[model samples]
Target: MIKKNIYFVPLFLAIFSFVVIAVALQLDTSPEMIVGDSMQARSFPIFLMILNLILVAVLILQFYKNQPNPIPLEKFPTWGSMILFLVFYVLTVFTDMFIGIFVVMFLMCVLWGEKRIWVALLTASITPALIFMLFDLVLKIRFPRGILTNIYYG
Candidate 1:
């Protein structure tokens, strides 16, 4: 029974990837160029979806070749990660993307059983700072206005 259920994961992923590819195909391909000879907006997403499908196929093949030991469902962090994602979304919508990133990183580190509080704090702080520097300073991209971003942009 467990062996049979394991295939569902890859099957669901494959279905989701195909659905995303279909939606990506429907995206408008206007001639707006962000850079010289840039591909359409949907190109990268479609490519990624195709790659996902390929990975799903590989996973299925691996499962067939080697019947792996089943891990307990309760041992998985799926629900916790999903909840964290929802919280991150809410934080990003209300507070700021930087705030969401920092909070989520810290929470995820703790959730995954990180023992050191200082390491979690560093991960939370440094990750957002690096992201801000890379996008705001290096790439010259402006983040949407929010609590922390407003201070930086102003």
Candidate 2:
């Protein structure tokens, strides 16, 4: 049945994600700070990995209970889109947050999205700006200052 295939994608993705996270959790990292704070850097990744594993199990159960032979192929976010999404995430590692967000937003708008031109531009501009303002202004958090940081906050 069509529904059977629909379940396959999430199931496969969940399994793959679980394996990747498990391996990452095993890899060792040196402590950046010895402050012994609750907000340690490695905490989020470990928490998310456990959460993802639980979600996958739940989805697998739902698939078996509802769809007899769930096939997950009718929908296509496509390999290229997935790769680009990953690239966007990876890009954040090498660059400042503002530049990284803007690059990813513009690419998503121009290459894959369906909004009107002005709308896409607005999204590319406004979303990152708001995020910066929220983190920088509201939360008073430190972020890597890209070119705009000089103009906006400097």
Candidate 3:
């Protein structure tokens, strides 16, 4: 039986955010020449960490206030899909992020009962490409060059 007081969700978020904030604090804060006095790279991460912490706090408070009833154990499949998504997301660090995005997006869309194959395929392909272009090109952020990246670039 799925317990209503699902403390795990908020607890996990709080722990994860705390860890991320700890790591973010260790980020290099050396001044950048071009963006003099402007926000450094670490600032964005720190900002996000703060936001995550706030969100986690709110969720924890809400959970405590509600004390909702336990859901059916049959809902495990939904949780399984979420876990699978997280697994795939983590795997992207070892492989290529774009490929991971494509695979995860397609599988998740299908799992969520999207009927149009063409729509899913197009979305899975285009969305990652746009993200790659925006971050890699426009924002000048470099992505991890895994084995596939090495082969392609070489």
Best by TM-score: 1
Residue-wise C-alpha lDDT for candidate 2, range 6-30, written one tens digit per residue: 5666678777777777776676665
Ranking of predictions according to lDDT? 1, 3, 2
Which residues of candidate 3, in runs, are more than 4 Å off? 1-68, 73-77, 151-154
After the best TM-score superposition of candidate 1, give how far the Cα of residue 93 lies from its true spot, in angstroms.
0.6
- The best candidate in terms of lDDT: 1
Q: Write the per-residue lDDT of candidate 3 for residues 1-154, one digit (tens) a residue.
A: 4354487777788788788878878887775786698887677877887898898888877777777665546565587688767868776877777677788888777777889999999999999888877886799887778655576457
What would the TM-score be for candidate 2 when compared with the true structure? 0.46
lDDT of each model, Cα atoms only? 0.89, 0.69, 0.77
Q: Is candidate 2 or candidate 3 better by TM-score?
A: 3
TM-score for each candidate, following the candidate numbering = 0.55, 0.46, 0.50
Q: What are the runs in model 1 whose C-alpha is more than 4 Å off?
A: 1-76
Q: Which stretches of candidate 2 lie over 4 Å from their true place?
A: 1-67, 74-81, 110-112, 145-154
Give the alpha carbon lDDT tens digit for every residue of 17-61 in model 1: 999999999998776655348888899999999999999999999
